[model samples]
Target: MRVGLFIPCYINAVFPQVGIASNKLLKSLGVDVDYPEDQTCCGQPMGNAGFENEAVSLAKRFDEKFKDYDYIVGPSASCVVFVRDNYGRLRIQPNHQCVSEGKIYEICEFIHDVVKPTHLKAKFPHKVSLQNSCHGVRLLHLSSCSEQNVPYFNKMRDLLTMVEGCEVAEPERPDECCGFGGMFSIEEKAVSVQMAHDKVQRHLATGAEYITGADSSCLMSQNGIIASEKLPLKTIHIVEILAAGL
Candidate 1:
């Protein structure tokens, strides 16, 4: 399948390694992946901040750029959630052609549910604390929660288990937010830090060497606290762990 890779602005700038690892992982699985250099933000920052006008402009730009692809995949759950959930709200005329022609997927969801790399050569011998990105968990319902009876969120855990020596640990509250809601950190620095601190504390309490998640933004927020406190935890994107074999 031909897929267009959309690396969000933050991932492109701060966590470029995750994008590179994602590309390598997909190609290793024999999927034809295309990187549209012109692709940009999905306008989630503005949309989450109540500036739909600004978000619409960026969303229009995104729709125009990736309109031809069969699938638009990315590493950031937040960005993917924005595109999947808000692209329809763009003020511009809906590119029905693109909407009908292309699909948006978070990399982990795509791999665990769609690609299903049954025999990965990857191995990570570390206890990993899984932090659920708010958009992915609460908004997309990517993970199974007690609130939902059917249990749908084990995709990440299942994929991780395939890696030899990798053990996934559940946090005290698996579905809590990391408080890295883009501008929410800066707008409410004190509360944001406190939330992040709590999340990191839970992970550290688990004695996990690495804290892994689908969103780098959340990891980055937690990393700040871990660094300041000199915690023995490292943060990684799920793709980075999967790409370890390569």
Candidate 2:
């Protein structure tokens, strides 16, 4: 099927490789992926800052750019959720509402829900821990939450385990926020840094060589701390691992 890849603005500027892996992995699974070159942020930062007027303009732009696609898929759950959740508040046109309401997907959830592939040609032999982004867990519902007391099922881990020799481990607090709430990180640097450091400590306690997650925002947040502190653990987007096996 033809799919439009939505690479968040931050990922476009700083973590483009994650977008590459997402595109390559989807194509490997027979998806025809097209990236709308004019795409920018999904307007999450603006909306979160109470700038709905500004956000609506960008959301309309996004709708115009991507509404005709078969599906909109991306590596960042937060961005996907932003479009799904806030586009309505922007009073998106009736004809265009469905684009935000239904046809979008975060990469891993897309694999599990849409592709539904039980096997893959990819393989990554490594000890890796999963970092659950807040938007991914709470908004996108990427995986089961620990606080829910429900059956433990992680769609992200499902794909990770499919990699030929990948070993997935969970942190003590699997779905806790990594503290990178976009503007929240900037306005509250101390709390954000502390939250990220605590998350790194839990991931490192797993003794894994790499820390992987579906959201680049979280990985990028922890990576800053890891680099500054000279931590041995490394961070990577989950799509990178899923693509590595191919």
Candidate 3:
């Protein structure tokens, strides 16, 4: 399993630890991992903002960077969604080849479905509210909602159950947007904050010590509001908890 790790721009800048943990976890499971320095943003931010034309160059760059890897695993679901969904629109010939040849996997999905760790050493006593990233839930369908009549899409829950003391809770309205839709946070600050506030309120009501999700952007959005309001909730990436051991 020659896996190339794709660290999103936000994770690369702010939560590099998540990327590190992901690499360590994968290697610990006996998979060969590689991080290509030439890789940068997956052009998700620009594509989400209707700037597909502007994103072409970045997409081309990313395509060339990791085209040979068997699988490109990313820590952020949104970034994976960006490449999985929009890489075909890059218009460049090599970009198309890259998308066709390389398999993109979000870290949780890879762990739950592909790697399937036999012995998880992670133990987290905190009850966690599962904040499903919009792209992962709505776009990539990484995990299924109970509202939907699907049976095979609960990979996130399956992985969480493997952790020793971790409990997963769903919000009042499962799969609601956390409002960190890339540039939406900047362009629609008021609405973005309100949505994040609502999400945090729901998480708080669950009485969870930590809110956890596969997407850091959604966690970051909720964490900011929780911090400003001085709430007792802390946000964590799912991998961070999974990497822990009691």
Predicted candidate 1 versus true structure: per-residue lDDT over 1-246, tens digit per residue: 888898999889899999999999899889899998877778888888888888877777788788787788899888888888767756455545436123899888888777877877688888999988877776656687756677455677877888888989978888888888888899999999999999999988888999998999999999999999998899999889988878
| C-alpha TM-score for every candidate | 0.93, 0.96, 0.92
Candidate No. with top lDDT: 2
> Once superposed on the true structure, which residue ranges of model 1 sit more than 4 Å away at CA?
94-102, 150-152
- Better candidate by lDDT, 1 or 2: 2
If ranked by lDDT, best first, what sequence of candidates would result? 2, 1, 3
Full-model lDDT, candidate 3: 0.82
Tens digits of lDDT, candidate 3, 77-100: 878877877777576574335552
Off by over 4 Å in 2: 94-98
Sorting all predicted structures by TM-score, with the top scorer first, yields 2, 1, 3
Worst 10-residue lDDT window, candidate 1: 93-102
Error of 1 at 16 (Å): 0.7
lDDT of each: 0.84, 0.88, 0.82
Q: How badly does each model clash, as a count of residue pairs?
A: 2, 2, 1
Q: List per-candidate RMSD values in Å.
A: 1.8, 1.3, 2.0
